[model samples]
Target: MSTADDTQKTKDPEYLSTLERGLRVLNAFDADHPELPLSEVATITGLSPAVARRCLHTLLELGYVGKNGRRFILKPKVLEFGSAYLHSMNLEQVATPYLQKLRDQTGDSSSLAVLSGDEILYLVHVSTERKIRLGASVGTRFPVHATSLGRALMAYQPDSVIDAYLDTVELRKFTEHTITAKAELEKRLRKIRQQGHDSAQDELDYGIVSVAVPIFDTNRQVVASVNCSTSTTRVSREKLIEERLPLLQDAAIEIELALKKWPFLANSLRG
Candidate 1:
């Protein structure tokens, strides 16, 4: 490659190494590791003890983290970090019509979610009139191993990215159907990718089932996901396989088109 080619390959220096490390430190905490001592944080983030302390102190000062005795825990104020992305993406605004239409067509609950670290964060949710519904709320977070939307996003990630993420995240089984083994999870995700949708049954919550598909940008990069959820008792697995999957796939195509035309996200749309 020529010098110009090498130059083009170099990453932007102004991205700020310190800021990136600080964010990584924040990501080291989750439901399982919600509170960690300085040493644990250092180990999780691969930062020196002193550096982790400094970073945690800085976060505490910014109201993003709080110290409880020897352990550090995230605070509610940290939600602003996620809220900023939600506001910037305008995901709810873009997905509302599609979710509404899906709910109307299938008479099931629909949701739009995005991956954040090892979890899926719901940005848009539309409820149905079913007496028994899958209770999911906007801004709720669920493990990647358990949720249909999470599996869809994980399935589309590059092999390297998926390996790195699976290496760091613990695979906890939420129910009997949850795939906890790394090899098994990868195999399942590969099937999901090949089939163009993820069908999860009673994985995240008992008696809940869902079908999900990736929502792509103009560049065809998976930017987010959409899922239709119902109670396990109300819908048979065979029906979801033969019916709901097609509906979810169709909605995904419509979402991709809308995402491509969205004024604010035009620059980020893949393909």
Candidate 2:
């Protein structure tokens, strides 16, 4: 999509210009660019300098942003927004125990994730105390096409939804193992649908291998996915599947049964 299209959408009367503009400014800072100057923020967000300044100043007044020299950074107060969302969902509280069981059984990191746009959003992650090369925390988002969790979730989605995503997404390669072709990704999703699980190795990050299975709600609709991931050095692809696939699948069932109590989430979290 073109910048014009995005700008046009933001012009709709129902949309709040300040909210959109402020979020754009806030999103300009990420892991790679933790600190950005006003000019850089405007350039990154496609907002004009005047608008960026106004948004930043508004955030500063709201205690969500801080300034050091010419650079602007997100403040700790901004975490309240995420905390509120996570607390309200209660997904972490529900899924952590099951993920912990998988972590303990496999001696690896396990996670629960849900579809968010064309990505998988981590809702809970349980990791061993041992240091690891790769790990994701709650709220981390990863490209759907490159993650087993994403494929497991998508495999259960209607064909039209999957096709819509494939038609719009540009599959960028993160590693040699990443499926950059739409046809290949479609084939993978189909296979996941047949096999009831998905696995990936060096797809998103080198040395990070994972297996994931779709999580279903009370009505049998897939709402989320559960995964166990580890470093390549610690686990072979075959062993990872042999050992953790059952655990992950069982955890999915347990989570599904547990999520029954939260009828709102069971109904609302479907892709």
Candidate 3:
């Protein structure tokens, strides 16, 4: 992509096509694609081979990407970007201790996340040593329609935004319990509003049960979410909620209060 290409695509005259193309190339690499051939990168990013090659060459020179034989792979240097953003926000610093407390109290895994696009991106995750299924960490993304964290943050979105989400996202079922119907999910969101939190049992992954609460900003806007997860074999959905919901709410409140000092951060992450 170039300045000339912008005439056919974006209306912004100041748009930098080279930077956008480079980022598109980088975005092509993900958990499922740890290594991708040059041709594959071009295909995935919808870039011509010449353009993708140029972008990869630049990243390779900058040590942000490495080539292993015929395939391209992201280097540790790329993490500096995400790490810089996390350090700047400082949300993890304020919320991790509370998440740890939730884990300790419930003997389950706890996590912090925010709505990113149509998914919930994990910003912080505190896990128990005893793992069952589906591992997650910072930067992990899951469909917002299938997890407690997703429902918690999404239930508070304005009707227009929620309508846009429903219009855009593909409601694919991850498990038998996953809500794949728009009407049903709309009802669920209403119920979440009536109560104060969201819970999922065998919705995203089988045997996984989690409950989450939305953390709000000073303006009462939902900014992020925190969740505690365990297994269905160990804890029933009712038991999980009975024991963990209040603790999750307390954590959300504490995080909200702590975020007041960093008012910019609260708004920055508002979903």
TM-score-based ranking: 3, 2, 1
Tens-place lDDT digits, model 1, residues 127-201: 987755347777778888889899998899888979888788898877777888988888988898888888888
What does the lDDT come to for candidate 2? Answer: 0.88
Number of the predicted model whose TM-score against the real structure is largest: 3
2 or 3, which is superior by TM-score?
Answer: 3
Instruction: Tell me how candidate 1 scores on lDDT.
Output: 0.81
Best by lDDT: 3
Give the 10-residue window scoring lowest on summed lDDT in candidate 1: 262-271
Residue 3, model 2: lDDT of: 75
lDDT of 3 by residue, 40-76 (tens): 9999999999999999999999999999999999999
Instruction: Please list the C-alpha lDDT of all candidates, in the order they appear.
Output: 0.81, 0.88, 0.90
* Candidate no. 1 TM-score: 0.72
Q: Residue 133 error for model 2, in Å?
A: 2.3
Query: Taking the tens digit of each residue's C-alpha lDDT, what string does model 2 give over 12-71?
Result: 888787898898888888899999999999899988899999999999999999999999
Candidate 3 Cα deviation (angstroms), residue 155:
1.0
